[model samples]
Target: MTEIAPIAKPDRNRPEPLWHQAEQALRGLIADGTWTDGMQIPNEERLSTMLGVSRITIRHALRNIEDSGLLRREHGRGTFVRSSTVIAGVRGLTSFTQEMAGLGLIVGSRILERDEQAASAEVASALEIRQGEPVVRLRRLRMGNDAPIGVQTAYMPLARVPGFLALEPSASLYQTLSAHFGIAPREAREVYRVGTVAAEDAALLGIETGSPAFVVERITSDAIGPFEFVHSIMRGDRYEIRSRLHI
Candidate 1:
């Protein structure tokens, strides 16, 4: 494979911070496909030498990009470009598989764990179920283009769903619930907050621990009433959160 050249240093006389200059240069490289997704980038020494900045400055620029979800730094390994992941707003109800497919991304998931459990007080409130009611907890590591992008942990009242896990795990959970479980989602509400990736999440998503991420909370209703809730953490770089507003 041909080694990608380091970005040229910016003019030092300019007033911009050295790290910001490096950020611009590196972003250009990634956008132009000089450095593709999952491709390892040059180390701090090389970046410092090529960008004519201190190692600390290079680190700062990389950190900024990583926080922005354009790059990921692996501990004891080098930084790499992040794969693009789509974010579909909950303007209305939608299926996860359909949402990703609509965006033309091949979506898959690693079913980290799945089982039935009693609803906690919070889960009970979200699902509108009695506390200790049986709820199916489906934990999955969501992926796009075969790259880990996010972690989705969903809870659905078992009484409202039947034979959910019997269907393919790769299929849309919402669809399965609607088709066989007769749990068609009619409405949904979502909330988001900036969060840090814990060690478990970081390992599952193939990013550094303490990386910036988005914590998403969602509750969806069937034609009759609400029965599902999801707690999801998404990689900031690979995935974006987008919405539309009407005037």
Candidate 2:
């Protein structure tokens, strides 16, 4: 096992022990993506030195966190953070705006473009419309803390939502549909893949071109019919999807 690095002190006179403080500090770093998955942490001696604590204290802290499934120790290498991918399963009816807001992140959108376009073959097939049917294309970049978090492109049949583009883009599209058309998105079929952020997406997301990104394709519908197709690319570091499963 790699040695733990020195832990940082919490405050001048906090009641917590050096070890517990060290544990929390390390946990924050790992959870916030400051310490990436599979990356070895600094040795225990370094942790002790940095945290103003003894090696024993550092060891105890590391042991606790490791048992929590946040850290994994290799035979010869040091401890590393567990992977940080979020896995929002396709098994529920959840709104992205509500979900992200509940995480205490400010959800905002900047409309990149909105236009009426003839349905492409793929769009037509997904929307179950004729090839030359009109569709509303809305491209947007989502931000949290003024940092780009995800890029989303949504498509809807013009006939289904007559004046959707006229509505403020920053507002929740789903909510607007619900209020105006009584069309609640009851469920969605989502597909996931690993992809590179392209040049345009890189600029919009303020990341280097070709950086790793999570690509999600979603088709949402109500009991009446399918309503929207959304393609989103989320930043790998800033967001994680979570899910629960039962036997």
Cα shift from native, residue 176, model 2 (Å): 0.8
lDDT by residue (tens digit), candidate 1, 104-185: 4568888899899999999999988899999999999888767787899999988887666676775578767767776777
lDDT of 2 at 216: 90
TM-score of 2: 0.65
Give the lowest summed-lDDT range of ten residues in model 1: 83-92
Per-residue accuracy of model 2 over 198-219 as CA lDDT, tens digit each: 9999999889999989999888
Which segments of candidate 1 are over 4 A away from where they belong?
A: 1-35, 38-83, 166-168, 243-247
TM-scores, one per candidate: 0.66, 0.65
Candidate 2 global lDDT: 0.76
Model 2 worst lDDT window (10 residues): 83-92
Q: Which portions of model 2 miss their true places by more than 4 Å?
A: 1-87, 241-247
